[model samples]
Target: MLHEIVISGFGGQGALFAGQLLAYGALEEGWHVTWIPSYGPEMRGGTANCTVIISDEEIGSPLTRHPTAAIVMNLPSYERFEPLIAPGGVLVVNASLIAQKSQRADIRIIYAPANDIAAELGAAQMANVVLVGAMLAATGALQFETLDQVLDKHISARHRDKLELNKRALRRGGALAV
Candidate 1:
């Protein structure tokens, strides 16, 4: 199976990091994976995104014109990527930050209040992780256990203290998907 996913949001919102976590989990599962990150020049608060491709076979390209799934953390990202999802694909929207509702009928839309959930978890920065959890439940691209492993093995030492919080955010988001 091949799953191409895009994660988009403002810089510093952990969009790229969320994609990296997916890549790491895919890699651990012995799948072929590629991650490409992009961001505007304005840096933090600017637009940032990353594309992650996970497949059982060798991948030929890193770019995808229409992804199989996407996680949009803001209205701008939601507007930009909503139309780019392939038919029958999944779209995870951050409902806490976006005011507009999705109009697409061909794709599955999951509205997750990531920001509010993260705030309740006491770390708004983990909103991205919350979305990742939602993506995990919605797509089943990677196992939840694999994500837990990725968090434990791949997170940097400096951020180790927030590991549990991240896990909680992930669980909260996954709950939304169910």
Candidate 2:
């Protein structure tokens, strides 16, 4: 199996981190994975994105012109990546940040209120994790349990205190996948 995913948003929105989590989960599942991050020079508040490719076999490259799935955390990301998803692919959009609706009919779209859900969960920064959860539910590219385990094993020491909160956000986002 193979899955190419893109997670995008402004810098500091955790797009790269979310992609890292997915890459970690893929690795935990014994899959060949590659994560490539790109950001504008402005850093925070500037455009940022990451591409993650997970495969059961060796991967030739880390880039994809049309990703099989995408998590867009802001309007700009939605605008940039929505048209790039492969036909019949899955897309998880941050409804709280994007005011416009998608017009595409070929791909499955999940309009998750990630920011609002994370805020409600007490950490708006976790909006990226929330979208990651939604992507898991919608695409099944990786097991949700794998993500939970990744959180436990790979979360940074500084954010260890919010592990439970992150899990809660994941579950909440997953629940919205339907």
Worst 10 residues of 2 by lDDT: 37-46
Where model 2 places Cα greater than 4 Å from the true spot, the runs are: none
Runs off by more than 4 Å, candidate 1: 39-42
**For model 2, which pairs clash?**
none
Per-residue lDDT for 1-178 in model 1, tens only? 9999999999889899999999999999999999999845838889999999999999989879899999999889999999999999999999999978888999999999999999999988899999999998999999988999999987789889999899888989999989
Taken over the whole model, the C-alpha lDDT of each candidate is 0.93, 0.93
RMSD of 2: 1.0
Q: Score candidate 2 by lDDT.
A: 0.93
TM-scores of all predicted structures: 0.97, 0.97
lDDT of 1: 0.93
